[model samples]
Target: MHLLIAWCGFVGAWLLFAGPIYQAATELEEEGFERDAFSAQIDTVEVPERPSPWWWLLPPVGYVLQRRRQTEYRRRIMAVMTQDQLERMVAFANTATGWLFVAGGAFFIALKETWELAEVYELSVLLFVLAVVVMFALCALHTIVRLRGTHQMLARSGTARNRDSMTDEPPATSDA
Candidate 1:
């Protein structure tokens, strides 16, 4: 019964992921978005004009390729963001990572291999504690970074408001 439940969850996850992947691939084939996303995702080898019926999977293959691009894209995005943004993201990731580890442990325990854990209680305790510490540290960092960002934004807005108040309002123009 446990195995059946796991299989069902796996299938459900595949279906959940398939819809978006299919839509993205279809859009890529349709040339809806920029050509680069399509090209980046697609296999480098060019397809022949009269390919076999088995070639129907080319776009699906491209979908897999597109998914692979996410890591590099995220790195680029992180590089360009302000310090505040980076801190918030890191904090979020820290907390999320802790939870994911917990979830992974839960999943492992639920599966057949959990019997092995009975003898390794120390390892489990150590890992769980480490995850919790990292999560808490991230939470503290998040608070500090958020407070700084808020102060910076408030200062900029206050100056802008002062300058605007100092300037005379433009006279309204009537359309002919």
Candidate 2:
């Protein structure tokens, strides 16, 4: 009875925490598409093809493959981005990673305390697994947010450049 109650509580809390992260990640992904659109507008930029959804049937392999594609895409973006923009992304990645580590550490410590007090090995292991899943999800979301921000910056810079160039040229006066 107690175990069931604990499980329910844990699940409820996980849902509450993960819901917003998932929503934010989805929004960021949509925003990231703008970067691809911007690239498409350029004549020489080559966008990489996305991996097939069928790859997801093989979990470990699929994850690695997806990550490789994402890294390659990010590298392409970074290639044209300014040093200041790159630095901002690096700093954000560092800070988000640090916070995740701290949060994971605190969660583990609390889990340990709970295990010692309750001696519920089954529940402890379950909690540990869930925590790992949550941590990884958070990390993925953070990466998405960071990349989205970079994409936004790049898109804005491109727009500003286009605007400047448009304004710089003298208007053509056609002689009737």
All candidates: CA RMSD (Å): 18.3, 13.3
User: Which parts of model 2 have CA positions greater than 4 angstroms off?
Assistant: 1-47, 54-64, 119-176
Indicate which candidate wins on lDDT: 2
Model 2, 6-123: lDDT tens per residue?
A: 6555454444444445444444345333444445434354567878888999988889888998888777877876676667556655655655565455555445444443444444
TM-score of each: 0.27, 0.38
In the range 42-68, model 1's lDDT, one tens digit per residue, is 444333334344544787765555554
Please report the TM-score between candidate 1 and the true structure: 0.27
> Residue 129 of model 1: what lDDT?
50
Winner by TM-score = 2
lDDT of 1 at 162: 95
Clashes of each: 0, 0
**Candidate 2 — what's its lDDT?**
0.61
